[model samples]
Target: MKKTLLTFAVVLAIASASNAQTKIPPNIEKLLQKNTCLACHKVDVKLIGPAYKDVAKKKYKPEQIVELIKKPVPSNWPGYIPMAALPNVPADEALTIAKWITTLK
Candidate 1:
């Protein structure tokens, strides 16, 4: 019983550590807040849309990401609802966010 409990605790700790969220840089965090991107996206976890880390996994170039922000493609993410186009986001800010997203694991 004692060995089983110890093994369970060890597995739980490993899982928790593996799933820990990555810390967002302050500058990027501010931009995300200002653009309201956090309303749907998170660094490591999926919210309304896919997680930034998942987006990073897609290996999209920063330019492509910026375009996606301005004009979302629903077909790219079948299950999730189409993202609203954020044409109002300044070009530079969008690029900044895209570059940061590409840096995610």
Candidate 2:
């Protein structure tokens, strides 16, 4: 019975992880590419920027994430690799990206 339960748990974990692979919204995807945000960030894996999964875990309101993207939060990220302020990136685009990121699990 213990072995059976363990197998079931493993299967469940795999299923959940697979189901949580969120896609980038079309406009957000285009914005990321245009703004070069994709160079440092990915929808799943951690690159120079933390993964979208990590961002979603913060549970911050969508508005907060938008502000962070526009201004950056080096303290929250903490490192020699400080987040660059995306002053050139439009605020509306950042908010769209933020809303999409919140759907990541």
Per-residue lDDT, model 1, residue 59, is 97
Q: What is the TM-score of each predicted model, taking all chains together?
A: 0.89, 0.74
- C-alpha lDDT of candidate 1 relative to the true structure: 0.94
lDDT of each: 0.94, 0.83
Question: Model 2 compared with the native: what TM-score?
Answer: 0.74
**Which pairs clash in the backbone of model 1?**
none
Point to the candidate with the largest TM-score: 1
- Candidate 1 per-residue lDDT over residues 1-95, each given as its tens digit: 99999999999999888777478989999999999999999988889999999999999999999999999999999899999999999999999
| True lDDT of residue 88, candidate 1 | 95
How close to the true structure is residue 51 of candidate 1, measured as C-alpha lDDT?
94
